[model samples]
Target chain A: MASHFDVAAYALGTLDARGTEAFEGHLASCANCQVELFELQELPGLLDTVAETWPDAPVRGAVIYGLPTKRRRFQHLGAATAAAVLVFLSGAVTAIGFLGWDGADPPAASEPPTALTRLDPVAEEPGGVRGSLESSTSHAWVETTPEGSRIALDLGGITGSTPCSAVVVSRAGETTEIALFDPPKKGERVVVSGTTPYPVAQIDRVEVRRVSSGKIITTLKAPEK
Target chain B: MTERAEWTESRQSAMLPRVGRHTRAVRPVAVVPDDPKDEWVRQLYRQFANQLSAHVLGLTKYDRQWTEDVVQETFIRAWKHADKLDQRPEMLRGWLFVVARRIVIDTHRGRQVRPIEIRGTDIAEDRVGVSDKADSTVDAIVVHDALRRISADQREAIIETYLKGHTVDEAAVLLGIPPGTVKSRTYHAMRALRRALRARG
Candidate 1:
């Protein structure tokens, strides 16, 4: 019992003979060490199998040993590294672009849209309301800008890359095709926007539907005036 | 032991058998470098090359070309970070494993995003999906990721005692520290690993 810190050492089976003897003497009466030892019992086995979880464990007798030491290998490797870096950069850029879209920033690539929140006071009209069709989730808001009414939509749970259109319908049964875009991959947020000449007061609903089938995927309603 | 002697010993031990099998494929030319950084990187590479290759080969579905690329990339990164990296053998191994593992993961994700026809038409249907198929696979990634989250010393401790299967006294010699220090580092590393696994889950 000179050292009670041999719990991990003993569990790891790394304790020297004398140290093991002392720890076992202490362990006979030590309930705390017993519990600690039991908890760690699985650790070594798990560690041994950690490398086995990958795709080709035991390697299948592949002759893939040693680093590529040739000068020619390094040449192509240089090109591969550049391409890999480009792919990584593009992925990062796409992520950042999506984050920007999630904000009030519009999705147009040519000219940046004026910030919707900074636009002239959103006319005292119907406020935004949440709506969904089936399992899909969607939200839409109409902001009155000097140019026209800007509708922002956040649609999620869309499956596949379907070409879709956002149509704004007024209470008077008139419809305006405001935006056309592809829905994002499944389980990802799709933030999009479209501008309409109609004001916020006149618009009654916004529906996102497949461009080909014209079937509604989701709709966001404007609160009644 | 001198770094050069250690490098030679480690390299020969790991490369001897493989070299005999594939004599033409590998030249096994040992280059003695003048620069300290080059020497350090060579040492790290020699010591951990086999371990990284095996782990990364498994990761890349034993794609020899891809495994070599990842291993190369990992060492390049280690070379770039050599100034900041702890020169200890165990710490270097941990750093290499984490970096190499991430390269494998990133390459997989990149391929998934834009399927590259590297392995011909039959792209191994199962690998095309998410990396979370099996609980053990997820655990492997989680554990490797957690290795980087802990301090270098603690990471080295776990590598010595658990991963490398070294006894406490043996680990002490390899780490150039006392046995008590090794014990404490292993204990702390275990706790940090537990917390990291929980956080990841």
Candidate 2:
């Protein structure tokens, strides 16, 4: 028999349900196992300390993360990729207008936003759509379905110094406004994933512009399919 | 062979955030890396750093210097891929836990060999460099240092059976000993650790 090492096994999370239940029976009586297991319980916490050091260090997080001190946004990505990303950013941001999260026209959504902690952080980019951006510092990809196209925009460096909004403007001057935010602090990346009701052909440009001054921070023209 | 983790309601609530009363229009979801200058991460570190440090330390088998370096590297990677991490508290904690574990695995894989040396009572403060004021951080360093005091065989037994989350038979197979030996070694290791911890205090 493996003997009364059940406490240790259970502490290590290696016990099956029956074994665990069996150990729980012993654990209820064994003070020695309880105390020893308590010390062993700290094992995982100590392991975490090893990696938690970098954040507590004197150097900046960006420098330690191996990102250059100079803010080279989208420096790792190519120009074509950047434009395509901007196209998606604008498209997705505009989709907020249709989807109903637009900051400007926040449709009757007076209710509190679902707790930020409740959101799934994973970026979901389904395959099968085409899009483009120009003169951009962001990256993007597109997902298309019979319903329409949704653009997944990576807002890595657009933490401008003023309130910002992504506006999708059609050739005929029609516009859908989405994603309004105060200037994000430097080095913060804001990401938006939204779908557009209009096909890629009908959209002329997706511009990330300052809401306060109406100046264009960056703009990407739609690439034709 | 396993610790079953049933998905209770609490653990399963990490679905994406939704808004409004009904589904009138498809919502355009956005995740802005909040507190980009390490504020949010700092808080997260404060919360989970102890548990994560302890687990990673085990993976490295009591290499304090190696553990500290790997933990820092993991968080840096977390920031670089910030958008992927913007989620609920429990999910964020789980995400960091997984990332820290992977870092430990990667760090171990890159090493030529495990040293298994006990530096006596000297905390690897030099390798950790900057002294963290957090009591949990200090305690982790101290406890890890003590693990080194026990014989390597006993320490390895404890790690395989306890920290690595292995069964006794599983640990015995890895350590090339009988299951009985794994237990005795673990029993002695725990006693030694308790003594060392009390002595350090």
CAPRI-style docking class of model 1 based on DockQ: incorrect
- TM-score of the A chain in candidate 1? 0.39
Off by over 4 Å in 1: A1-4, A51-225, B1-135
What lDDT does the true structure give each of the candidates? 0.52, 0.48
lDDT of 1 by residue, B53-171 (tens): 99788778788998987887676666556666665665666556655654665466466653343221122242422132222322333455456557999878777776666778889
Worst 10 residues of 1 chain B by lDDT: B128-137
In the range A135-167, model 2's lDDT, one tens digit per residue, is: 123433334434445444434456557788777
What is the CAPRI rating of model 2's predicted complex?
Answer: incorrect
Error of 2 at A189 (Å): 45
DockQ of every candidate structure = 0.06, 0.06
lDDT of 1 by residue, A1-225 (tens): 425567766655566656655555454445565556545543443343343322222111010111122223323546665445334323211111111222222333532212211223321322211111111133343444455565555455555576988788886878988777777766555555566777655666777788999987666553322
Give one digit per residue, the lDDT tens place, for model 2 in B111-193. 64434542212223312222122123224434454565569898788667656657777778888897667767776776665
Cα lDDT of model 2 overall? 0.48
